[model samples]
Target: MNHLGSHKLNNVLGQILLAKRMGKTRVIAETGAGQHGVATAASAAKFGMKTYALFSENDQVAPVYSISAGLAYPGVGPEHAFFKDSGRVEYVAATDDEAVDALLLLTRKEGILPAIESSHAIAEAVKRAPQLSKDNIIIVNVSGRGDKDVAAIADYLEKRNTKNQE
Candidate 1:
């Protein structure tokens, strides 16, 4: 409903919360640049569907730089493109090192080990914070737990350090 908040809407849409009503086993979708395919796959898995595109595990995969599974797609979808064209959104990027550094900073200061996907937002907020007035607020979605990424991040850092020493 129009009066429902975003959190409520998410709960209603989440298959776990409304399984009887919203659970679906099949999806028909068209994708370009792979974003819709990834989302469709994710949705299918969440709805207890047995399969997703290509991958046996229905796992979302991405290139090394974007180790965040959900965000591993090649580009934003049509709606996002429309938003960009309309100047409703300003897209920016963060390097793997920047995201890693931001992740560490947040963990050390706030005791929250945000997901690697979220670390990019943290990096962006950090970049823009100095330019904005002190009263402004920036909200970064820490979408998932960081524990799973700890080993990967550690290996990445170790490799980077070893390379720097060479």
Candidate 2:
């Protein structure tokens, strides 16, 4: 399937566009893996908007993801933080194991290998899908492909297998 390498870029661009439409001169955001920050900076530059990206110095989940699937990030986008605070978006943390499970499920079912970040979103959707009406549609942003995570996932699964056998 053809997909954006960093799907989150679309959101960042959309926010920038909205800010521009509203006559804002500056765009500020925070990012974890630098993807959103990079995307925001690029979009802002395109529109001649001043941009700032505040990255987190410490984030608990970043290290684990870095080791497990190489999807670690120090922080999320500031807009995401704002949405969480305003009740427009709910933030959920998925463990490496859960994300791996989601990755496997998606790969097996849809034949698509999703990035670790995208796996987190997929895992969240799996958790919420059962509660929603059948008519409801859930859209997940698959920010990137999992080609880079193949080795990491293999290592994770090998360790898991060893642990299960022991």
Candidate 3:
């Protein structure tokens, strides 16, 4: 029921169907924690599109526990590599701190607890928002609920507080 959860599926379905209509058999995507990857794979499978996901090699960061349990990976889907070479999709990286900050900001402002993966997109948007004109429209996909991340976030904040006090 998260805001951007269905958007991912829709986007991937659109891409896969478009490529299929264009006679393309393969689809690829880049994901930080495999959320989009899983979605893309499912959609591609539905459309008979061969799917590949590209994942980051090093997901170790401040939220290592969440990353490891949720989306950390050493390799991406094979098709993602091919797409990267063909310029079909762009890859970007977000730091752990950026994600954490974005998560906090969105929670405080929008009252939404975004998944860590989705927080990366929010961080990117927050970075780009100030550079754009006031009338510019931006859409960010909030992929999932952050309920699962509550305990981890609490631990991280507690540690941060301890460090600040010391």
Candidate 4:
């Protein structure tokens, strides 16, 4: 796959198109940083699958990008948009914790793991989801690893401590 900034979404779109040719009817995924969300929605649209995405609170991109891309697909609609756009399928949760609760409910009702962008959140969400004995199926986008997040976390914590002491 091409790096985040590259237009490597073509690879994903190819896969979705192939799946559609093979008779697959739906596609689902999760997003964190918005890159994967945009890509997945585009792919689902390409394949004409009923696409659904689940995004985390940390997502920094507009959901409309993903939603519109999905809606542009033959069978998909804004309702399945996970990131942005206004429709029944798109659901915005207050936090990752809340998204997890919704994912758990979805797993119970749908028997599938909803897509999410964070690898860290996926396992926990899957475990919390009903009937998910194993969390291996949850695909985490892993946009940035712990090494990348450490400096940011430390900075935030230090600022938080300073604010608390003030």
The lDDT for every candidate, in the order shown, is: 0.63, 0.74, 0.72, 0.48
Give a tens-digit lDDT track for model 2, residues 29-56. 6565566667777777888988877655
How far does residue 11 in candidate 1 sit from its true spot (Å)?
24
In model 4, what are the clashing residue pairs, if there are any? 29-115, 30-115, 30-116, 31-117, 32-117, 63-83, 63-84, 64-84, 79-89
* Model 3 residue 63 lDDT score: 22
Error of 3 at 77 (Å): 1.0
Candidate 4: residue 120 lDDT (0-100): 28
lDDT for 127 (candidate 3) = 91
**Stretches > 4 Å off in candidate 4:** 1-6, 57-166
- Candidate 3: where is the Cα deviation over 4 Å? 1-68
Q: Which digits, one per residue and each the tens of the lDDT, describe model 1 over residues 11-92?
A: 2234323332444344333333344455544554656653333332445444333655656544333344445556898989
State the local distance difference test value for candidate 2.
Answer: 0.74
TM-score of 4: 0.32
Rank by TM-score, descending? 1, 2, 3, 4
User: How do the candidates rank by lDDT, highest first?
Assistant: 2, 3, 1, 4
TM-score of each model, paired residue for residue: 0.60, 0.59, 0.57, 0.32
Model 1 ranges with Cα > 4 A deviation = 1-65
lDDT of 4 by residue, 51-165 (tens): 6666545555443422112122222222243223334333322343343344445557756554432422544545555666554455535343344433544555577579879
Root-mean-square deviation of every model:
11.2, 8.8, 9.6, 12.5
Q: Candidate 3 — which pairs collide?
A: 53-77, 55-76
Better of 1 and 2 by TM-score: 1
